[model samples]
Target: MRSSVPGTAKKFPLHPGHPERICWGCDKYCPASDMACGNGSSRTQHPAEIFGDDWFEPDPGADDAGAGREG
Candidate 1:
């Protein structure tokens, strides 16, 4: 039987990571491995904690990113 819920698959995408979004399933920082939804989901304070927005990509060393003077 078809589900009444709209976008049923969207509610819980099978892969759990194709959209490159923070996995709501594992709640951990990952590149969309094989995350599965369960009672083991964890929570972090910052977005970087999950994706590490700073550590992974260090300063690009450019005028825009490494600009010392304010213009």
Candidate 2:
């Protein structure tokens, strides 16, 4: 089951066209330069930035083809 944590349960886009403009640290989705949460850190990088464009895609070498499928 997915966690009920604040940011953890929020919906996030898989491939935002512009990931650099917003901070992903919190649900506020603050502007990169203006982090409202003040976590004492720079903007959190979107998954795409750290893992390339296919970050959410299933690994081709994985054996579990139905791992993330709903049905």
Candidate 2 lDDT over 1-71, as tens digits, reads 24577547567888998999989887677889889999568999899999999999988878686678897
Residue-wise lDDT of candidate 1 within 1-71, one digit each (tens)? 24467656333233332345444443334334444544244422233544554544555665477457656
lDDT of each: 0.43, 0.84
Model 2 reaches what TM-score against the true structure? Answer: 0.69
What TM-score against the true fold does each predicted structure earn?
A: 0.19, 0.69
Q: Which stretches of candidate 1 lie over 4 Å from their true place?
A: 1-36, 39-41, 44-47, 50-52, 58-71
RMSD of 1: 12.2
Clashes of each: 0, 0
Taking all chains together, the TM-score of candidate 1 against the true structure is 0.19
